[model samples]
Target chain A: MPHTTPQTPGLFSLSLSKTVEFALNQALRLDEAQGAAFKDFEDKTFAVTFTDLGLTLYLFFTSYGVNVQNALQGEADARIETDLPSLLGLRETGRLSRVTLHGDVPLAEALIDALTSIEIDWEEHLSHYTGDLIAFKVGHATRSAMAATQAAKRQAGETLKEYLQFELEVLPTASQLQRFGDSVQRTQAAVDAIETRVQALLDRL
Target chain B: MNQSKKTIDFGFSEVPLEEKVKRVKGVFDSVAGKYDVMNDVMSLGIHRLWKRHTIELSGVRPGQTVLDLAGGTGDLTKAFAKRVGKSGRVVLADINESMVRVGRDRLINEGIAGNVEYTITNAEALAFPDNTFDLATIAFGLRNVTNKDKALAELYRVLKPGGQLMVLEFSKVTQPLLAKAYDFYSFNILPKMGKLIADDEASYQYLAESIRMHPDQDTLKQMMLDAGFDKADYLNMNEGIVALHRGWKY
Candidate 1:
């Protein structure tokens, strides 16, 4: 049996479960397992005890959002089975069957959940902090603009054209400038959006 | 009996097929010594500005590879080597052996030796592996290619992911009055300048005609997109006498 010790929290430290210990002991009897490192021996048989864990981890790490079927197809097409099976104590059909049959899904599911939760938390924190700053800046500009507009209306003295010209000529307050900038940005975004759609259409032709 | 397909337009003039290459070669070979001189003379030193603009648009950085296609006399290639630094490489390639040899010797004489390679390659049939180059440029060379689309596709194939292709070439004039004046200057005055300066009248005449026959801006942009380039766009310069077309492989 392979003896191990815990190293860190949440990260894999030197610790072997009872199933892992049993597999390691059984693997030592095989000629292929002779002179092999503990990590190497465990990798060879973990799949038998952990069935498809190596492939699953490989697919997840390599193609982040790829579907399981596609990942499997890619692995099979690339002839990864022979090397992978031998490397992980999946030497015999019986050992492979045992791992697949006994390995639990809850651990893999828990790992995925933890990773997703971390991503969401980081994004949420950035948005909240940035959004607050933007809103405060916008609010201050709006108040200043409104005051200037009212002052201009008072000074313009009744002729509609003069009042209109005054309104047009009034230096845009920071809020007004921000709104103008936003509109220009939105217009540019729309142009880019349309260009992409048009390009896609052209590509089909 | 079908008339012997005797003459084809080298630009607009009817020239025999055997004569076109000789004519084209004469244009570069004649201008070989004064090519840089005449560029400054003809464009009133705005050629330097245009070449600088091309360099700026190239987005060349340290540790990047660049291929200056149809690079005559090594002007652009010299500037490119400095930007790419000692770690990066620049190849000054031209189809014409005379132009290539002249450019190579000029660069060697200038002591711009390290990190530069010279090759005589046709734009349509570049002897390079696919997706190897970071950037490829055909400065004033696209119009002369026998098959523009094939050359463009070849350029597309050589570019690595996120690589750029820039073409600085003559384009259609936008203003009618400017077009008329340009035509008169190109047809009448340029040949006279060529005869007096370079002593080659027919070669400069071919240059003027080729500019007119070349496709305009919008057509080139569409062709670039068809060649699998994303965000293909052009910037017209000098009332559209010249345009810089840019595209990227992603």
Candidate 2:
């Protein structure tokens, strides 16, 4: 038998809320380092209500992970109502200090911590399709190449700036170029002095 | 439908066994558009909770085969499709083509049809080989069957050994006070609401009468046992206004 005891109803009674929550869980898998900070979210109730979209889902965090339902089975420890844009904004900025909270502030903070802490195991995930060794090698090589590219880009930018400032004389001061503005007059003066000296020397000879 | 000596309960009235299916078809055809809305109102939106509890108790496994008899609107079918997932098979079968079409269309619209198949089948004679299913369910649909005993036997025939059968239906209320209040609401207000919502008063009246005609919880459990199911038991919900009977084949 499949795991009938998935902490929720069977698929025969699968609601949209449960499926959405399942998709979210599958999308986010936490490793130990990032997940340890969110240990406080364990065994807590977090509710997100989208009043405009006509949806309210209660998320129960258990020993394993979270389960979702449309109706609240008990008094929620934290409740927040926001639209899609506000939720997306929260994800990007990560500063939800001003939102109205119905219950424990720490619970909401723990949710943010847990959500932001999710670090997907790309190697393990890719191994499902590709073999483990290949996936690890690919992931490792990709990460190394990215770091090398970033360092090379920084080095190239700094070297270009130095070349422009010292050799090309494009930075810090334009005043040094003022002497070159009358180069033609200076050249003509030197030529005339040289011609006069040459005529005198010839006459003396 | 029996040719010899046959009359079955069509709501409060007795009709030829052959005619009951046609009359039931009429009722469903009349209310197919408003079926989901009426279910919410008639059950006071608690039907979802009841269904959830029923599915929780079913102990269905992945890669298992399920037969959803008279799976009107595919409520349980949709839910089971998720649990069984891609590896499992869930056949949403109904005797009435109108209900089957509605169920198929609704399930497709909801994107729950990946592992599901539709069949137009009568419970009395399921169009499948013996030992075809790992689990079978008849939710709210069994009450409309003209021959409950024959249908029960057919369900027993189709299920594989170690399989389970769950029947969810309106049954005798355990508490007398609540039962009396429920009776008044079922007989009186339910039909009027049906009239207002579905614009079909007689169909809702038949629905109410059909609940009364269906066997009580204990009787249903005994009938399951008689049909070769073992360890038959029932769990009543909402003061027995509804009951879920679970049994298994050895």
Which candidate's lDDT is highest?
Answer: 2
| Residue range A25-50, candidate 1, lDDT tens digits | 34333425342332211111111112
Residue A124 of model 1, lDDT score = 29
Tens digits of per-residue lDDT for model 2, B1-250: 4475598898899988888999999999999888999999988898988887766566554466899998988899987776665667999999888888989999898877668999998999999999999889999999999888899999998998777788999999999999899999989999999999999999999999999999999899999999888768888888798998877887
- In model 1, what is the error at residue A9, expressed in angstroms? 54
What's model 1's TM-score?
A: 0.54
lDDT of every model, 2 decimals:
0.63, 0.75
User: Largest TM-score belongs to which candidate?
Assistant: 2
The DockQ for candidate 2, computed on C-alphas, is 0.02
Predicted complexes: DockQ each: 0.01, 0.02
- List of chain A TM-scores, every candidate: 0.19, 0.44
Q: Give the backbone clash total of model 1.
A: 8
